[model samples]
Target: MVKPTYSPRRRTGARANAPSSQRTLHLGGESNPGRIQPSTKAAPIDTMPITSDPALEPLHRATLRVIGKSPGTGLVLPQCHIASCAHVVGRGTPPGTELRVQPWGRQPVEVRLIAIDDNADLALLGPPVDAPCPVELQQLMPLPLDGQIQRGDRFAAIGFPKNTNTQTIQCEEIQAEYEFYTHRQNQPSLLKLKLGQFRPGFSGGGLLNLRTGRICGLVKETRDEYQNLGGRAIPIEDLIAFCRHAGLPLSHAEPPPAVASEQAQALAAFLQQLPKWQDLASRRLFVQWALLNHPHAGDYQPMGQNPAADAQALALATLGPGATDAGLDAARQLLQRVLEEPVGKATKAEAKRLLKLLDA
Candidate 1:
């Protein structure tokens, strides 16, 4: 397996040879001002070893065993073991070199080079020996359209944090903000997480949903105090892009085309059978799910008397208190259609009421 190397851009004049005492004397100074300071060249960063406890061994091994399968392939796994002080070395090494990752517990796993996005501190990993692939890549869950993640959600972190032998599995209630910034198109959005502990080895672990076991975010970083300092996970959407780029299989096992097609038909049929009141909510949920899990679903098209126009009108009428200014603008466009319609007095009255609330 080839390890990935990060070669930072060579800094100009940053590697000059040390000046001898004679040379220093010639400059009329005891120390050479041009010489790099020892502090500047000290070992990249100090890493702390997580305390070894027998209880954590299985979790650590389990995570490593699963992630270690693809030695040099850069597919990010749900379970990641991070050293206390691993620095993000830029792409400085040769392409095929096996990158040595020194996790806390077991032996160093030779990770194959996959892909590394320096801005995101995310690196894709291939399967390792004895590492079982997750049922899915964990990132296919639907994001709530409202963009709200409440506190107290149950979450788990799987990683080989300390060592290979120490599988420290940790689960906790989410408390603080999992603040995140994205630079995909130079447009950054702050995503806050609602759960989990930011333990040392859990850097690349998945922040998974307790209900469906789907992944919500990639474990990025945590606050130092572990108090209100919340841990951050990369959203699943980003993970999908990363995996696709790395060419890793999206699911642990591939299903036959017939089976997949049948599943899709069944879902559509089921939705069609729903009651009228349930239709909108069900369709909305389906649309959100399709957006993440089935990108091929095409764009969302509302259906009804006015179809797209009515859907937009409803969305405008129901803007939540937390709606942003941009969201409000979108609602206005939709509501305008409702106002322009020729309707009975009762219907028109209701529309006027909604428009009034929106204007307020």
Candidate 2:
């Protein structure tokens, strides 16, 4: 991944050799001086691994995974439109290259690229007419409309980091005054944040307020190690400007209440029950059982399609807060089956690890 330019320094020469991820050039406008780094370039887009029971939120339903030869992240807006970094959505690839969006617990949908403003480093994507219902945009918190944000305000971010798993960073801070990206034309304003050690693939995701659950900004870039691990984001005002310019409808809804703790409890119960689950579709069936039978049903969406790695994911999820009595009994049975069956070394090791956890 390319590091973003920092120090608020003036550009002395043209950046022709910079990685495409950092090339935030203005389209159809005069050049400006600033730095840019696309969030999609955080990992290889082609190697997206599937995991069962991702513990997604309703808000997360609107956060789509953008995949192509160049994979990235996108957010479903009130217009049923997907918003992402221009570099991520507009990057050129081989012929027939298409943008595929995978919503939480649903089939992937292909979208039509609508408008791209390189100066703002923003792109608007609309779903095809035949595509399934757009993600739940109403669950998202629209920023500035809810209230004013200032320095020291707490925030959170969720995105498909490394094109592998859904990861989140909670309790990030607004560290500096908002500023414009002077390097691109029109000089769009961006939010400055103190996000230490951010993961890759969070580039096009929302910077949601911790208190109100509203989206304050769209993550843009991260500074180098010398710059103390700071990051940049496109402020909500800029996002509004893009929507208006693209003629797309924008929603200004209040974000829902926080549900992290509730979700955690539900996940714990589901993981605890998964070991004893012996069915044709263990992951989905087990999670469904927990959601319906446990007290934490409101906290989580049921598990989606199961894969071979699901056993590993279930084992890992169980590590937090440990397992229940029923889980230990089920785990023992599962591990015995694995030991008696013909599976790979990795699977065998994973089974051993899970047995140890159950014993613990």
Who wins the lDDT comparison? 2
Worst 10 residues of 1 by lDDT: 20-29
Each model's lDDT? 0.34, 0.46
**Candidate 2 off by > 4 Å:** 1-58, 91-98, 129-147, 163-186, 225-228, 251-360
Candidate 2 residues 201-246, lDDT tens each? 5667666655445676687766643343546777665666667767
Model 1 misplaced stretches (Cα beyond 4 Å): 1-62, 65-94, 100-109, 127-153, 159-190, 194-199, 249-360
Q: Cα deviation of 87 in candidate 2 (Å)?
A: 1.4
lDDT of 1 at 178: 29
Error of 2 at 152 (Å): 1.3
Residue 135 lDDT (model 2): 44
lDDT for 239 in candidate 1 is: 51
- Listed per model in order, the count of residue pairs whose N, CA or C atoms clash below 3 Å is 47, 5
lDDT of 1 by residue, 258-352 (tens): 22122223223333333331456544543343233322222222334433343332332223323344434444443354356454565556545
